[model samples]
Target: MNEILTKERLIEARERISNQVKRTPILTSSSINKILNANIFFKCENFQKVGAFKFRGASNAVLSLNEKEMINGVATHSSGNHAAALALAAKMKNIPAYIVMPKTAPEIKKKAVAGYGAKIIFCEPTLKAREETLNNVIQETNAIFIHPYDNYDVIAGQSTAAQEIFAELNDLDFIIAPVGGGGLLSGTALSTKYFSPKTKIIGAEPKEADDAFKSFNDKKIYPSINPKTICDGLLTQLSEKTFKIITNTVDEILTAKEETIIEAMKLIWERMKIIIEPSSAVTLAIMIENQEKFLNKKIAIILSGGNVDLKNLPFK
Candidate 1:
């Protein structure tokens, strides 16, 4: 097939980073299945290295760079998991990583990034400010800018999660993942299409951050402005590359309300005894919202991450 990403690329990524990243487990909850009336599998990326699936992408991006590119190291702007993932990946490769984070970022996340030995530059929380700060860091260090979700290497790396899911369960009727900058969702779409052509790929998002949904329906990329959602990982808008992949491959974008997301998060904690972030809960919220459509079907949900700050939880 004529595609920007290929099965060979994803296979290469998995081989390259096999020793570097973890093949997180796939979990099934009988209670959850009974509640939704669908056979559901949860690809627990929360158990992934660096506590999120971002590690897979970061490891691939860092490892793909040659010695010359490694000299100056890599840099990116992120307030949460990506920063930590890139920093840890760079450390594993014995290279430097520069991360630009907003000063208002949660203390736990800031600490995690710094703990990985990345040099952190703080800026305002706005996109313009983050971009300006990241650009400045790049200029000063001459580091390669490894965008969190836009780069082909990163997408290929992220696809491995969905690839694993399909490998473990070939009969999934639908594979759902949360959409932020559309990295995970786009990667899932690509891998789902390649590995299990019969399975539909769905992108889930918080209603508060429904840029992907709007973009899907409008047939164009749309930006999220001042998104006020508990799912911090899904606040960013999609990149051009991700937008293209989502538009071409994703079957639909489902949005969940804030209450639904929180409730789903709580349910997972209560029943599955897993701590998933609000972004991960978006997938379950979408399924719960459209129960009848998925009833009795086999579905797989990508639990994107578990990096929520317990101190600032959405649920009481």
Candidate 2:
């Protein structure tokens, strides 16, 4: 387990990126608590830099680079959040960033990355196309590829969000987070294990994009194939590093239907008065579905992002 990501490493990462990243607040809603019959605390990473928790890992990865590694700058392929995050983090360090984004990526995200001054390459909406385009960019620019969720540094950085949760709230019964590439989930698991070992780590995914759910139960990595869900951020499959970490540390993986996801997102918007993307609501949706498991329990949910395009609201 130490080989994957040590507690000491997580602490160091927190300190490393503390100055760069936002220490987002923990928020709660009485309406949500009464509706779910559980004490829920949300780590609002939506307020984080780049409007998502991805900035935490991106900042850490970019800042961890040595002078030699920083020479060629960094690159990554993301549908939105990570691309914008890496671009902004690189821009902060005055380094070039090359981003490969899917053509179908949200227009707001495309503009955000470009606004950060990163060179954006558009590709088909397939993981293969994104990776192929990224490879060509790396070959041409020799940029250091900072994988969205696969790298240990990125994972360590993501752990800090859970670390923050544990710092303010003690003895949580469970820490739930949305699972996409498993970067955030794996990192949350590690933080739970190290900071509050008794607290279980739960990963929530959309049923339409249940690769992480299937992979966790099967104890094998599964590619995300044609996932169709409103949670755009939860479409990526788990990598070997994140899969191993999640399987070892995560207590369970739960899934929510598309309708439930939308319902959850709408509930937060109306009740909490905060905007959250569909992916961020998966954790809450699972909680609503599995109310029995979490009834009267103290839970911490990571609101992973708030990068939704306002014009494309899912609510009626």
Error of 1 at 213 (Å): 0.3
lDDT of 2 at 118: 96
What are the lDDT scores of the predictions, listed in order? 0.91, 0.93
Model 1 compared with the native: what TM-score? 0.98
Tens digit of per-residue lDDT, candidate 1, span 1-316: 3265888998898888889899999999999999999999999999998899999999999999999999999999998888999999999998999999989988888888989899999999888999999999999999999999999999989999998898789788999999999888888898988899999889999999888899999998888988999898998899999999989999999999999999999999999999999999999999989998898999999999998777777777
Which residue pairs collide in model 1, if any?
Answer: none
**For candidate 2, lDDT tens digit of each residue in 74-169?**
999986788889999999999999999888877777888999999999999876798899999999999999999999999999999999999899
Worst 10 residues of 1 by lDDT: 1-10
Clashes of each: 0, 0
Return the TM-score for each candidate structure.
Answer: 0.98, 0.97
Model 2 misplaced regions, further than 4 Å: none
The list of candidate 1 runs beyond 4 A from truth reads none
Kindly state the number of residue pairs that clash in model 1: 0
